[model samples]
Target: MRTNIIRDEHVTVSYDVVNGWTVVEVDGDVDLRTSPMIREAVIRLLGEGHRHFVLDLCFVPFMDSMGLGMVVAITKRIREHGGSLRITYTPGPIVRVFEISGLHATYQIYHSPEEATQRTPSPDGLADWPHSPSVKKGS
Candidate 1:
């Protein structure tokens, strides 16, 4: 894993590439203050031929509308180019926000970065689904 830090006045975006996945672990607040930087970093990785992404939001304290918008925008961009975004290890508060806002339904959420990176495409082969046995029917 290789970590890259993109620091600014209000927030810092730390990312790493492991195996074939680019895991972007975001810290600090992601609001109007820092969404652009985050977007740029993710877009750059996509431009560099990274099709799989794991966004680890375990350390993020807060994410506002701008942050949510950036995520949606990035997801759309990835889909346009036949890519995917997996959010993993997000804290309860952040997870709640995503759930409440319906973003969780639009994106794949995982318990850990490793799990996210290891996920395979769903039956349709266009989206990702949980690999755990818990996802099985009648388990």
Candidate 2:
């Protein structure tokens, strides 16, 4: 497995390939200030010929519209290249944004990184990811 790390004052991006999937783990707020780090990592991974991605946002407590937009853009690029993107470990506020923006159903979302990799995709090509066990049935 190959590993790469990028750190900024606001965010840190680290990734490695496991079982043919590139797992990018972010530790920080993914707002306008930090989206670039994530974007660069995704672009670098694409350049490296990775077709599957798992974005682990477990430690990201906040993500503004810019961050969400970057995620959407990356997803589009990956799909254009016949790749797949799975998002895991979203914080509550971030998850709410995704739900309110009607994006929860668009991306494959999972409670954990392990779940993200193991779940099978639904007919629509999105994984049937369940809510995090730590989160209650309804907020």
Candidate that would win on lDDT: 2
- Name the lDDT value of residue 87 in candidate 1: 78
lDDT of each residue in 1-139, candidate 1, tens digit only: 5666687767777777765667898878889979988999889888888776778887788888899998878877776667656777555678788878876665667777777766553323224422222232111
TM-score of each: 0.80, 0.81
Model 1 TM-score (2 dp)? 0.80
lDDT of 2 by residue, 7-115 (tens): 8788888887766567899999998888977888898888888778888888889988998899988877776667767788756887887888877766667777776
Off by over 4 Å in 2: 119-139
Can you tell me which runs of candidate 1 are displaced by over 4 Å? 120-139
The residue pairs found clashing in candidate 2 are: none
Residue-pair clashes per prediction, in order, are 0, 0
Model 1 deviation from native, Cα RMSD in Å: 4.5
